[model samples]
Target: MTHAHAARPPRVAAGPAAREPAPGALPAWLAVLWAAALVATLAFAAVGGVHHAAVGVVTGAAFMALGAGMVVLLAPSDRVFVTRLFVGGFLARYVAALFITGAVMIAGLPGLEGGKDYLHWEASGWAVAEAWRSGSPTVHLTDKDPGYYYLVGAVFALTGRVAVAPLLLNGLFGAGAAVVAFFLALQVYDRRRAAVAGYLAAFLPTLLVWSGMVYKDVVLSFFVVACASAAIAISRQVSARSVCALGASLVPLFMIRPDTGVTIVGSAALLVGLTGRRRGSKLAALAVAGGVLLLFLAVLQGAGLGGKMDLLARFPNPLTSVAVARESWANEVGAGSSGLTRYLYGRNLLLAPHLLLAAMVLPFVLPLPGTTGGMMSIGTFLMPGQILWLLLLPGLLAGMAGAVRERAAAGIFLAGLVLAMALGVALAGYFSNPRYLVQGVPLMLVLSAAGIGYLRQRLLLYVSMLLCSVVVFCLYALARGS
Candidate 1:
């Protein structure tokens, strides 16, 4: 046996350690470059002396630094803490959004010419309360949404000081939305991807500019993201706890905007059906719970708990009428098909390069400039160039397709719901703007991050990074100049 034994091959022992890039392997030179870029951006903003430009520049730089740190720290970590990433990105985004919003607020503060009247609602609410107390039966008002006013009234009733309360509340909601957005992204992707997505949502200029304003958009966006996040969590595997959260989150959606709430419910139902989890008693219980909630909302609306609820019930009809009226007004204003179409086309063309440039640089830069209302306020039908920016939707769709391919079920579901909602608004003849599409922006970034992850060539990654930097710098410069 020993003489006839076959030659034995040498056995290699397996080790605990796995091959990885050396610590500090990433180019130090790149870090230096990022630092230089941040400094240059701040310098440019300071030199330009645009209103509150220093705040913009500094806040933006801080975001960039934090984002870069996150990227560097997480790049080599094999185990990703999804929650930590989400929280960190949320904090970064919130800080950036808060700073930009403050700048806009200062610019539009009540005392300045053409400045925003932050105190308008507060003053009006007090006036109405005073009138009501004085036995004025006909305390009528044009603004029907009473949620903000009621909250303000309550504050005034308690404190006898109503200054800036409404604006503060709106700012709080906006900041809260930024936090929720981060968690929502984390629920769908790994920590790194979620961080990027959250950062994108938080830093996007449109959201920053609009969130702090006393408007419904911030509240709506918060509820929308919360509802979507909850639904996605339930779809992954319906737990009693998750179901409860989903149900609770829906309440805010209904309260803030009933039409959007309906859309969310419909999306959830579609998701549940597609998931094929119909046989269980738990599922049955969840259905009943959802039904009860809907019934309650209907009852409350009927009883006039919130007049907005009643308005919501008649939304479809009134929305159609508004659309018709808008069209008629456009026609009367000589903004008919030919004129509006030409304008839309021209604006779209003009903005195309800028938007494309923004897309490239946004991923790399921190505290990216918020989308000022200037461009988006220009009606879509009146500006072709503006309509062209809608191409971002297609880009987002492509990114979503990539998510689907990767079997990111949650991402796909959320993205689908967002697309449906956006399409509904658009088809109703409502004009589209980058701000309107901000909710979908995270999914787009997630897809882009996934794509980048798949293409792991160092040279290519660096080249892409360079391109992003250039785009961000150029866009910031242009926005400042404008």
Candidate 2:
């Protein structure tokens, strides 16, 4: 349901030189940067004791030096170079993801104390693998998503009981989501903003750390971004490819997290109805919306919700469900430290706005007073990342404003998606964690990029670094005080 408004050109200026570069060609230096990132990944991996540590260190060292040398040799603003940065940023982010995954595996795996959710999911996967190997392939977990377990099982079936299966899968999916986020921004905004969105999606530490783990958050995030990206594409131009991507993206989302899928589809439909003009586009949107609803019902029934509605019966009041779940999870994960956690420990409709605010800010201001004991806290190791997010918050807001001003339909869709997901997670309660908030990270990143576009690059960089330093100092002081 898009309005027939003309798309606004972005504010960022492209330098003179090759104004009409060949399509699909990027700067060669990006490849070098990507290579460097890979080498950096190997070095990080080696530090985690994954074997070949020496080789990784040597390889990374050489690549870093070479990439550095090329940085001076290459200019920043050739048409080809500027256009290619998005792809390069996407690829290089994966290398960074490798480093994160390696570190997580090194620190948390095989009895170093990690999230219970990880243990449960991994165990379920192991069971699924065993079942598949034995020709049963049936999962008995009443409350879990069978698709995730089966996915893990399939990996085990093919590769045989590898502990790293989930880690690698998470990393790949996370990386793919980052790229898709870039493409999504490109579909709706200018290349400069798209580039910012892509790079932000790649390096968001929360995403990086989650990608390194053996959980469904990253997987869920990938599908969410995929569905959103595909939706944006189809909304703008209904094509076989866009339609296919949209349809395909829904399949996994349905399987992995039907509830989330339902919310996302519903949100998209509303946006379509509000913004779309073409009859064909509207029909296509309706088809997808209806398909997603039916699929969600099927998943629920298959998961045993149809006959008894036992899960629904447990929480007579969904708002209460949200509150209880959030509080319980905080205690379980040691996230009780935050002021927001304390404020949200009890259920009340009056707290709805507060709930949204808490959800939005928790990713940036975490490990507050009550968050001292949980495995998810990671013992304040995430503090710096939190600080970075705080620094970017203003930019994220500005970007959202820019998106709405420049591309109202897409911005509305993103806002609706984020709001709907927040409500869904709150209502569902038990499994709610900030990890689920990762679904909104790409949207925020896109907005942040737009915000960044409004300022001079050098000025923005200096301000960002300054803010970062101050945040780091505050974090250090807080840590010491604690």
Candidate 3:
């Protein structure tokens, strides 16, 4: 029943073997310069009250320097440099993404209000601390989940209250998500394409904006990517170390947001049930894990611990009171067509079908305005925008089609997509925000890369370069404004 005795498939050609180190690799001194530039840019933003223009100049200079260092490090001939660059690039991207998002949130975008919900969370965390100081055995501050708040509170406690911590943390999560996405893509595609996708996901504008905020979406994104990466590793019959890594990734899901945790656990159980050679044993192990998780949750709730456990309660009834509360909040926030009352009652009913369609299509077509400085305003409905966006749909379809011809990639794609969709639908209430679609970003990138790979001789190169240019421009605009 084990993989050791499982049916073996025909072996494909192994990937490239290790090459000898080249002497002319990027010098250590150059790497140090790149790191110093990045560190200085971040430190200046953290302390100095610089203008947006100045901050942008510093940020761009640092990133550009880092990118150049990466190019030198990745040079194929310099195997040692290539290895160093690959590792350094990954770490640099993670830190840079976090710093940039934190800086932007600290800078505060024009017209976009700042420091409302975040302040509230911090206050709630303070309340938790006050309760602890008293003789209270349990601390129930507010309805909001305290996991993120506690983490932020610890940072605030150490640094004497900074407004940028939440955003910075979110950015860090975004960067982590990007790194995970890159490795996941590499598993399905080649190393170069995977690296590109990872970098794009990290630096993408919409992602950057979210990273700078105090929200659970970015946190959810990190776990989602971790889950996907774990699944990919498992499918490849990778090392036991990889399996342990997958299990460890799932731990955060349980604590960050229980509903997501349940969905992930359920999906993993389902996959194991459907595919595991020792189905009974696998199911038993899953049941034990699920039971233990539920018991822990029950203890937390019974102890009157902080925050609402609505995430657990909503599982049996997906259309629960929480959904109703969210709908009410959305109406209050004027999310739909007209006034709150109208949108809540008659307008929502009228627009339900169209909204559903938009929900399905927007993720694919949206050019991620965070990347393009032009606000994702009504202008996105224009013909040029429509044409540009349509390419993603066909690109994704073509990649899936191509995967059908390549069984290994197909399995990875199907597993990842199904898990993604389940998580997406489970978190459907937040679909209005493009950042919720971050998990799918890698899949889209893979498809786009596949399309380019498939049509390398035709207009593919030109088209890919054009898209890349647009994306880079958008990122530059975002960074400049920050």
Best by TM-score: 2
| Predicted structure 1: lDDT | 0.47
Model 1 ranges with Cα > 4 A deviation: 1-145, 151-165, 279-395, 406-408, 432-482
- Give a tens-digit lDDT track for model 2, residues 210-269: 655566777787788878877776666668987887788888877877777776776666
Residue-wise C-alpha lDDT for candidate 3, range 309-413, written one tens digit per residue: 554544444335434634543553244334433444444454344344334444544333342333432222122433443454445545556666665543444
TM-score of each: 0.53, 0.68, 0.58
lDDT minimum window of 10 residues, candidate 3: 376-385
Worst 10 residues of 2 by lDDT: 300-309
Best first by lDDT, ranked? 2, 3, 1
lDDT of all predictions, in order shown?
0.47, 0.59, 0.50
Error of 3 at 443 (Å): 5.2
Instruction: Using lDDT, give the best candidate's number.
Output: 2
Please say which candidate is ahead in TM-score: 1 or 3: 3
Off by over 4 Å in 2: 1-114, 141-144, 279-349, 368-381, 405-407, 429-432, 455-482
